[model samples]
Target: MARPKILVVGAGFAGVECVRRLERELSASEAEIVLVTPFSYQLYLPLLPQVAAGVLTPQSVALSLRRSRRHRTRIIPGGAIGVDTAAKVCVIRDITGDTVAQRYDFLVLAPGSVTRTFDIPGLAEQGRGMKTLAEAVYIRDHVIAQLDLADASHDEAERASRLQFVVVGGGYAGTETAACLQRLTAGAVRRYPRLDPGEITWHLVDIAPRLMPELGERLGDVALGILRRRGIQVSLGVSVAEAGPEKVTLTDGRVLPCRTLIWTAGVAASPLVATLGTETARGRLVVRPDLTVPGVGGVFALGDAAAVPDLAKGGDAVCPPTAQHASRQGRRAAANVVAVLRGAPLRPYTHKDLGLVVDLGGKDAVSKPLGIELRGLPAQAVARGYHWSALRTNVAKIRVMTNWLLNAVAGDDFVRTGFLARRPATLRDAEFVDAYLTPEQVREHTASLRAGLDGPPTG
Candidate 1:
């Protein structure tokens, strides 16, 4: 008889961890591991701002799927557009835009998430995002290009508009992006003899009452002070009402002339979740404590795609879609998959958050590890240490560490590399936002798959 095929969708932290665990735990005769994802690398999302600010190269954060300890995984360069639970088949749209169906005895859904955007006028077109590596690269180039144009211009009005930068969402991503990029521009202006350092302005806004409230009020204030101290206009309880080509209108009737608008507001679960036709809470699949999908046999879901119950918190509390939780869930889910195969007992998934860490660029940072507050160089060490230790490969760690040391000494050259071919500046182009299929399309594909294969296979 053929070995059981385990198909895992997504190559995010959760999916990658699941694959690594499965490879480590399962033997060659036990099962075949298949991973479907659009990208070949697992993006280390926490330090993405450092990539944007030139503190770290984009390659350092991208962990290759093929370079694991054991080469057991079969990687498909595709995105899972839909899952047919009854058929035990997943419809994947590959990088080339062709759809294919693969049957699996067990399925793991970890499609991850996309940038959460609003219907504000001109937001999608005029605004930029920091979600993908391409976005980070593009944002870096765009920021530098703006400085170049601003410095070259004799037009005071154009220079003023070009020098202004606006970042929406006061959460960790936005706060860090603003702080790091603010520092980047602040330092880069010293190279421009024609431009005054004070001419560069950065505005950070969020609908929340406080910046990084998850860090608690004390650390939030500490973060706020750091940004304000750096001359970044930190606005709370306000957001962008509209984004334009030349400026943004604030919800509180304030207009800021800016050429750059970065939207790091939040993330919504991948649209693939909707194609599963399952119970979902807040746009994520609702899974049991053991990370199994209810009413779906041999199916498990985790990460940003699944609302895995937080047994530690109890009472309908699903785990937050964070990398820390996702990594743990991946391991537990893999073990559960094995238990299912061997007719053994399964384990429940539960973990309390250790704490939060916010890197505020340079030697500044704020962390609440194990509920103990820390700041400055000490917090910076903790934050960087956690990230370095979490990296899966030695090369990634070495590159990141070397980049940090080199950047601290030499600083950013502020040179736009223009590494990405064609230079995709929009979020949809970079993120493949419209790639997922509808339920009906999925059903149609399932019908075609059944006819072609003469119904689902029995292994």
Candidate 2:
């Protein structure tokens, strides 16, 4: 008999962890583990700001999937465009645009998320995102290019627009992005001798009442103070009302001439969820405590795509789309999948909060591990130490550590790869945001193929 195919759609923290666990527990005869993702590497997303700041190379944070000792896992370099639950098939759009159906005995959906964008005028065309490795790398080059252009321009207006930068969001992602890149320009400006450092300004704004409300008042204030001390304007209760190539209008009635706007506002569940034709809570697919989608046998969902109930939090609360929760959910989901295979009772997922860490580049960090809040050098130490330990492989750990050391000692070469220089780095150009299907479309496609009317997969 053919082995049961265990298909996981995504290679993010959750999907990667789930596949790794399945490979460990199930033998070659038990199940075949198949992973679907556009990228071959599992991106360590938390340190993306460092990548943008020129403190770490892009490849350093991208953990490769083809690591040693995997017996049953097959990597599919594609994105799941739709899922046909009744047919137990997943339709995928490969890198070259061809489509195919992957049938599975068991399925895990962990497609992660896309950047949460808004209806602000010109934002999609003008604003940049900080969600992906490509975005991070592109931002670094783009920021440096601005410095180059500003230095060469004699016009004060052009210089001001070129020198000014803006970041929207007060969460860890946004705050750290603004803080790190501000540090990047603060230092890199010295190399461009003609450009006045005073002209370089970074504005961090959010619609929230305070910065990093997850850090509570104290540590959040500490982070806020550090940014202000370094000349970053921390403006809460405001966000980009409109964005254009040369200027930004704030909701608080402030107009700023800026060429760069990095939007780290938040993320929504991956579009894959919409194609499943299932219930969702604010964009995330609804899953039971056992990580199973209701009425979808042998299928599970986790990561940013699933609204897995927070058994720990209890009552209506669901797990937030965080790396910590996703990683834990992956392992538990693997176990549950094993139980389903053996006709055993499935176990529910539960985990306590492990606290938060914000690496504000260099020697600045804030951490609340095990309820102990820390800041400054102590926090930086804790933050890096946690990240170093969380790395899945020794190779990744070594690469990241070497990057930190080399960055601290030799400093950034401030070189741009220029591969993506010509490409516009906005959301519309950079992200595959359009590659999605409606539930009705998914049902139609899968049904047609199942009935042997399979023409070209795209048809």
Candidate 3:
């Protein structure tokens, strides 16, 4: 008899963890594992702001899958476009635009998420995202280019517009992004003799009443204070009303002239979740406490794409979409898969909160570890130490540490790669929003494909 095929979608923290555990627990003769993802590496998302701020190189955070000890798992270099649940087939489009139907005895959906955006005007066209490696690199170069342009331009209005930078959202990503990039500009401006520190402005706006509410009130207050002391304008309970090529109007009726707008508001589950035609909460696939999709046999979901119930929170509390939760969920999902294969009982996924860390760049930081609040250099050390230890590979850790040391000693070069200068790196662009099929289209395509595979009706 052929071995059962386990197919996992995505190469993020969840997907990678699931595959790794499956490889370790199950022998090659027992099951065949396959991972489908567009990229060959699992991106360390939390450290992405450092890449954008020039504190770490892009490759330092991208851990390669080939380096895994589990060499038996096959990797398909593509994105899963659609899934035919009835037929147990996943439709994948490879990097070259070729399509293939991958059959799986068990399916794991962990496609992760894309940047979440509101219906605000001009956001789709004008805002740059910080979710992907390309976007981070693009942002760093773009910010440097702005400073260079402002320094050379004779028009004072144009210079001011170019110097003004705005970042939306005050969560971890948004906060770190604004803080790090603000530091970048602060240091880079010294290179421009014509540019004055007052001409450059960094504004961070969010719809929430406070920044990083998950960090607890005390730590959140510390984070806010640090950003303010660094000259970052923190606007709470507000958001961008309208964004344009040269200016953004805030909800408070303040029109700020800014050429750069970075959006880190939040993220939504991958559109592939909807293609499952299953129940979802807030656009995430609904799964049982064991991480299995209810009523969908041999199918599981985890990570940002799945709404895994938070057993620790009692009832109706689904786990928040975070790396810590996703990584643990992935392991539990894999264990359940193994249990089913071995005819053993499955276990529910549950975890305690490990606290939160917010790195505000430089010596300013805040963290609450094991309910103990910390700030300043101590928090900064803990934050960096946690990230360094969490990195999947030794090479990655070395590269990241070396980069940190070098950055502290030499500072940023403020060089623009010009790779994405002409290309739009908005949320839509990074997520490949155009490639996904509409709900109706997915239904039609799935039905049509199923019909073709099952053959014509009997006469």
Give the Å shift of residue 154 in candidate 2: 0.9
Worst 10 residues of 2 by lDDT: 450-459
Arranged by TM-score with the best first, the candidates are 2, 1, 3
lDDT of each: 0.89, 0.89, 0.90
**Which 10-residue window of candidate 1 scores lowest in summed lDDT?**
450-459
RMSD (Cα, Å) for all candidates, in order, is 1.7, 1.7, 2.5
| lDDT measured at residue 154 in model 1 versus the true structure, 0 to 100 | 95
Using lDDT as the measure, name the better of candidate 2 and candidate 3.
3
Compose the digit string of candidate 1's lDDT tens values, residues 1-459: 999999999888899889999999899899999999878899999999999999999999998888876977888888888888877889888789887888999999988888899889988888889988889988998898889999899999889889999999888899999999998999899889999888899999999998988899999999999999999998889988988888889999998888899999998999999998999999999998999999989999999989888888889888887889999988999999999999999899999999989999998999999999999999999999999999989999999999999999988899998666345477777778888788888888888566666655322
Show pairs that collide, candidate 3: none
TM-score of each: 0.97, 0.97, 0.97
Look at candidate 1 and give me any clashing residue pairs.
none
Q: How well does model 1 score by local distance difference test?
A: 0.89
Task: Write one digit per residue (lDDT tens) for candidate 2, span 275-301.
Answer: 888899999999999999998788899
lDDT per residue for candidate 3 within 49-74, as digits (tens), equals 99999999999999999997666889
